[model samples]
Target: MAAIERYEQWMARLLLFNKPYGVLSQFTDRGSPTARPTLSDFVPVKGVYPAGRLDRDSEGLLLLCDDGRLQARISDPRFKMPKTYLVQVEGDPGEENLEPLRKGVRLKDGMTLPAEATRIEDPGLWLRDPPIRERKSIPDNWLKITIREGRNRQVRRMTAAIGFPTLRLVRWSIGDWTVAGIAPGEFKEISV
Candidate 1:
């Protein structure tokens, strides 16, 4: 293969990363006073960038790609790409409490598109680095929440809106790609 062809092949790669808690989605933490872990620490592959962000406090599947169009499709709201999450909320909410999320939760930004939300058994994920605080008197519930809109902290806010605040959040999948076997701070590459 020609040098240019090799470069193009490299650029067409897609990476599915299992982002651990407290890691920034970007390559660097330029503005923060304190240095923090970022993609550069986990992903050494050059050229690829995260398609969408998973907040520093949140963890799980994050797609990275060097192809701009593919990145846009995964991150852009117009594409309506479904992103699934395994959430641990502060209270034990019943199906009635999750209805609003399925119908569309009104957020400060606006009403979100209806989501696929359901209570789920513990997903048996690896332990979080710091671990979530446990309240003896209060119970937490696990939920499988899938949303098409990529809003900032949307899942956490939605749960709060329904009177159940999120204690922990993990992105399980985006479209057909999933974090199924990828361990924290690890990544797998796929061709576009």
Candidate 2:
């Protein structure tokens, strides 16, 4: 029975965490002068690490797992797992403005692969803490952007490259798993 329990513990485990804004994706704050909220604040499960990084400011679905192979499959750009984001940008953009994103924008790193970009109605997600800054003069627009590669701050950079700066960014899904039904700072575990 003890051996069976141990075997079960070693079995692949996955967690879908609804990462909130301003929270770091890592488990610890490391050497930061000021302590910042991290996964440890929300997820108490041991041995699990984030499969891919979500920037401190970005909110939404963040995958954590105990298996290294599973982590690599999710995080590795080579796997080309599609990551989709619901982005609110500063200005209302027409299809022409989003064309650059669909065709792949050239960044300082290199040309990105073409992505699926579309203007979307507000997804009406939960209100973010502290809220996004609002400008009465400029209208904001929502976009559903899906990309296969996980680049550092890629979505924000992509929108900016096309003349619309993202005001708020929420990662809605990573492949089949999504942030749906999970509230901020909460996580659901699953066995793989």
Candidate 3:
């Protein structure tokens, strides 16, 4: 048995997982016609659950907690934890393209909170499977954007509004945790 087995009934522990694309956040999905494994396929804890959810279409760092209290603390927007994303947009994002993001873009739902930081590039990156389509005439660029809120498809929408559609989106980090060193569909326990 694992060391964590002994503490199952008592203390709660935090774990970091690298959630790969196309995996659902829930343990079971009766609605789907086909079978696809959930976090259970990667994590074998009984009481543990994801703190926050990454969409089935999105991929990146995910936090799970064995304790309900700790789960609430991390998932709650009240905590205001920052999430950083490395986005590949459909076109070159110039200085002008970043201003609205830094200042805060007004989405149809509401005004998005300003990003903590926005940079033009991140040299350390990898190509995506089923690579984003290329428009021979139009070039694309990468942007590392960090924001506190996790609105549904917010990054994709924001970039599209700024005249640069999002070709791909990946959450690189959340709070103090990151997806570094872990490959796709792989996960490792992180000390909180």
Candidate 4:
């Protein structure tokens, strides 16, 4: 492809990343004594940046865009775009235990917006390189959760507050986009 062709192509699309565990969502490395892997490591595409963040510990679908307006639309809570997650909790939290989360669980920061919570079967998503530890005696359960707001460690805090600590958290979808076809450390750009 021509240089201008490639530039235009790179500038006008959405890049979906299935961010692996331990990778920073940003393009630049900030302040770790050891060099942590970043989105830049996998996505060499220029101009586009992550629209939202997925903590270094969390994994799954992360969106990137060169268009600032589209980035705002995806990341702003006021837009009420849905972000869904498949969360594994430390214990078997019955449906009733999740009622508080659905009703907006209060946290140190404040009450979260009411969200969608449902006990679900294992999503059969990709395995983490370093898997979550298993305690044979303690049971674990999965949940399909969708929240509109993005807070720091929000999913983990919500589950912990309700007495079921989070084990593994994977963002399954954002708005209509999903990590359904992407694999860890890989990414693809799609037309808006």
TM-score of each: 0.95, 0.95, 0.87, 0.93
Give the per-residue lDDT of model 3 (tens digit) for 1-192.
Answer: 677776664666777777777788877878879888688777776766889888887778888877777787777877878888888788677788799999989999899999854656654665556566888999888888888887888888888878888877788888888889877767777444
User: Model 1, stretches more than 4 Å misplaced?
Assistant: 1-11
Candidate 2, position 178, lDDT: 92
**Span of 10 residues, lowest total lDDT, candidate 1:** 4-13
Candidate 4 lDDT tens digits, 1-192:
699887776555789999999999998887878898998899989988889899989999999988888999999888989999999999999879999999999999999999899999988888897999999999998998999999999999999999999999999999999999899999988977
- Give a tens-digit lDDT track for model 1, residues 6-103: 87776678999999999999999998999999999999999899998999999999999999999999999999999999999998899899999999
Q: Write the per-residue lDDT of candidate 2 for residues 129-184, one digit (tens) a residue.
A: 98999989999999999999988999999999999999999999999999999999
Q: What is candidate 3's TM-score against the reference?
A: 0.87
lDDT per model vs. reference = 0.95, 0.95, 0.79, 0.92
Better TM-score candidate (1, 4): 1
What lDDT score is found at residue 165 in candidate 1? 95
